[model samples]
Target: MPNNSLNYHNCKCNIDVMHLQSQDIPLVARLYKRSFQNHFLGHMGHKFLTLFISEFVNSDANSGYVAKYRNEVIGFVLATTSDNPFREFYRDNFMTLVYLTISRFFKDSFIRSHITKRLGHVHVALKALFSFSVRVRDSREKQEICLSRQPRLLALAVDRSYRGLGVANELTAEFCREMKELGFKKVGLSALPWNQRAISFYIKDGWEKEEASETSISFSRLL
Candidate 1:
């Protein structure tokens, strides 16, 4: 069962922070799209986003939480004590995702370009075998698959209308508490290098900067 604990009065109405239920996926996915509008994942559309977010909720390695006011989900956070969330998502949904990607590729020019770029990165041999007009998936999965049990905050999102009212703070605090209570020694997360707000937020919350690359900056906090 999901945790139905924690409530905040930072706003006039009580904001309840609890474990995410199955019914909350659509709302959370909507929030994710709104929160990451300029990102590649956001362009995947609602149905894809629905199935993507549902993987986090359904996986035993993942934990999800939501903040609500008057029973409306206004924010959500997803974490994992292991790295199997994405692996499992693609494993179970590959064919379906490929169909969706093919449909989107023909309909959306941006998706077509993105898939084209992905195709460019494939090996010459693999490309020959998969020589199709357009590639179906945008991401190339690594051939070597190894699972890790490191606790990491996967994603956090809040409704635009509900920001700055302590909703994000409560969600982060609760997520950390849940990880600690589960015997995790530490947890980490990464934000895109250009997302200054997210980098600042993690730093403000006492997550020490760990490492960085062209794409992302990593932060960690000891439990």
Candidate 2:
């Protein structure tokens, strides 16, 4: 368990949460990659974070929050809209969107060509067509899997050095307050089931689990 005695006023730590700018993207991603290294070791790599820094940092500036102390970023909260919250964001983030589309196109093209060349006679045209339809439906389903009512708090991490301090609570509370002000009725976050400490923290702060999957538990708070 984390130390419970640390308080913002008496800790002599300067905690300030603010919106991160484009220049801060690299530092933020670096900090996040370091803080979450252990948790995401087998799941993702540093280059993925580095390459997607722009998409993560620029996803939803108003909903993203970062905590700094002594001029260094100590923690961050990254979020994305449920389903293209604003049409304008689609255009603004067109570069990343296009990148995703192009990658998908090439990936599908390569897979189709490989299958056609290798199993040309084994798999009939009807079977290949059925397989292609299944793949398309699965891809679309994955893309549409979003919270219906609340925006997701996709990632949140605190530097190990600052964990015990009330920074996490402060950042989370600020996120909830901001979402409430923006007319959202609730906010959601997910964590691995093994992280009992995080689960307890969320429950202590009034977040209740609305869903549970094999690897994660989704928590939400009514705003």
Candidate 3:
């Protein structure tokens, strides 16, 4: 059941924020696919997208939250509280990853566009692995300040119809409150450079830009 219900901007309707559960994966996957229609994960197909969201929920149920309106899930936030999230994710879901790779390689589209994107994922994973290793070798100071004990907001999406009703704000505020109770000094998140709406939302919510690059911008806030 949802933890509690909240009014959206003094509206008559209420939104419920709760811990994400296994049963909500399908609905969340569909919402994610719709929210990020042009993104790579959306293009990975519904089955793969479901599996992707499942990993986050399975990894740390306490760190994930869902927003429901009228008993229907309308948005979700998936995050990792582990210090080494990538390594932990690979370790926990290695078998699934292998199966998906093999199946996609053989049964998926053989067209150049699809094949290229699939290969691109492999290249990106390898590069990220190498980058992680290097960061581990370097001092903690050199690593992204946001990668500490604080939880990282990995993915967040809301149904288009519910975008401006303060669902995102409530979800984030609740997560930060939980993190503070767990003794975290700060919480962090990142967004693509082009996601100006997300960036503005974070800024207005008291998060400060901690780092930036051509590809992404990282933000953190004291909890």
Candidate 4:
């Protein structure tokens, strides 16, 4: 159980939830990497991870929030109400996208490790690439045709030390509240099927599971 008493930093205060700032990106990125180290995004280098989070912060369609305890960011969430976040991101940051693409192909050590592990099999790389492409397309189609234009939570991360402190709950509640104020009727999020803990958390937080595929489970809540 997370300690609810906010008595850190030698002061009596409550966790402060606020709009995420540019200065907080690095800390949030580091926390994200630590929290999801087994996920694909986690294997990405720090530079790429920073750029990834920057996209959300810089995008007009996206919004983010951070939870501060004693003035230090302990958790953060990023979301977008855009119908097609990936397409919008690519359109808005073409050059950065190109750079990242090229960098991944030639410079990413994680990619190299996978290639090496697969015994330099081109087919393995090709298969992974094709699978990723298909998933991306399917997600976009689902959002466009089956889902409403409500905010979709892209990423939510809390520092290990901050887990069980209600930081995640607070960040999510804030995200949904902001979405509602922005004229959205509901909000949604997706989690890996294997992430039972996260799924349970969302369910307990008032989100209902809407759909599940082999790769992910989708959840939503009416605002």
Candidate 5:
């Protein structure tokens, strides 16, 4: 039911999707927490979320778009042109993210359990960070292949109050347009199978379901 009348050529649309900026991170972070309460990143606290979102502004590998309706940030979409956005963020902000993660883990039992459950991922990330230089050439080779095939959509969310108003559609279109402008021929994303609303929206918005595994349903769209 999302409205798809984004007039990128003019100012006639109901909401405007603008390139995300530093000042937009705070609002976008709060929206992320509200929208993703069940996700591990949501449990990482507001300060952590703020720092994480700052990467979208501060890093070159990752970028995002924010939607505004009458000056309020109603939604946002995040996308990465390269494969190692998380690794890049971890490499750049290691000590800070470590401090934040440890602080949250001790203070919140939920995070402790979550972290414990994902220790294998932590090990791989740590290994990747330490071996970055040794593997950069090979990693970049694979990244080039992946980048040429499809840049991934990292996250997309809309303000619940503004659903079905074309904000998600416009934000998605902006993401695709930006990626295509970046020389990518396709854009890809995934959704939790239980998130029927999001899955339906992606399909209705023109993404083709490409794969379905236990954890997520992947979708891709050509420019």
Candidate 6:
């Protein structure tokens, strides 16, 4: 069985944070879909959002957390401890996300018939092959793929209504403290660079960006 009943609460907000139960799957799915859709709605579409959330929720490699106010889900984080769920389709998702981004380039009529479509297939195939090869190599190189025995912070969101109330900070800080107490050297996150608020918050909270591209920034902190 999973850790279905951990008492996760925001000390600053004084609200209970629920460990996601399987029964909460639908609600979790809804919140996740809504939260991400709201952020990337124009960039993608309902189909993409739905697909990603479903993968996050149903995957064995992943687990989820949610923050609620008055029993209504206000925030969520979806995470994978190791590589299980992704080992299967990691490359698929990566290629899909990339394709979704560069698809406009395929509009060139000259290449659409031969180079473009073929390139997309090749990209996906190469991604999958690379993913599989890496996992096998990693497995052979290491005795164990040691993951954080402590809970890791995954995707975290504060509903707009709860955004400015410090709930996000409180939840993240608490998770960070938990990781430190569990002897983790640091915590990791990837924030979209466009989300200045999130970047600012992490920086203020002592996290630093390792790399920033036009799209995303990787963040980490020593516990």
Ten contiguous residues with the weakest lDDT in model 6: 1-10
**Deviation (Å) of 86 in candidate 1:** 2.0
lDDT of 3: 0.72
Winner of 1 and 2 under lDDT: 1
Task: Give lDDT tens digits, candidate 1, residues 1-223.
Answer: 1223332343534778998888998888888889987666677788888988887665657789998887888888888875534655665666677777778777777676666656632343243344443333432222112122568888888777776567877788898897777666688898999988777778887899999999889999987
Among the numbered candidates, top TM-score falls to: 5
- Candidate 3 regions exceeding 4 Å error are 1-8, 11-13, 58-62, 99-148
TM-score of each: 0.78, 0.63, 0.74, 0.73, 0.84, 0.59
TM-score of 3: 0.74
Question: Where does candidate 3 clash, by residue pair?
Answer: none
What lDDT score is found at residue 81 in candidate 6? Answer: 49
Candidate 4, TM-score vs. the true structure? Answer: 0.73
lDDT of each: 0.73, 0.62, 0.72, 0.73, 0.80, 0.57
Q: How accurate is candidate 5 locally (lDDT)?
A: 0.80
Best-first order by TM-score: 5, 1, 3, 4, 2, 6
lDDT of 5 at 210: 95
TM-score-better candidate, 4 vs 6: 4
lDDT tens digits by residue: candidate 4, 71-183: 78788998887755555444445566456655775876666565454443334334433443334466566555434576799888877776765678888989888777756
lDDT of 5 by residue, 67-112 (tens): 8877788899988776666776677677777888889988987797
Superposed model 2: Cα runs more than 4 Å off: 1-8, 11-13, 39-47, 58-62, 84-148
Model with the higher lDDT, candidate 3 or 4: 4
Best by lDDT: 5
Off by over 4 Å in 1: 1-9, 116-148
**How many clashes does each candidate structure show, in the order listed?**
0, 0, 0, 1, 0, 1
Per-residue lDDT tens digits of candidate 6, residues 1-223? 1122222343344555655555555665565555654343223444344445555555444555666665766666666545344444435566565565456335433333335334555555455657644443654343234433323456777765566666666667666665565456777788887777878888987887788888678888888
lDDT of 1 at 195: 87
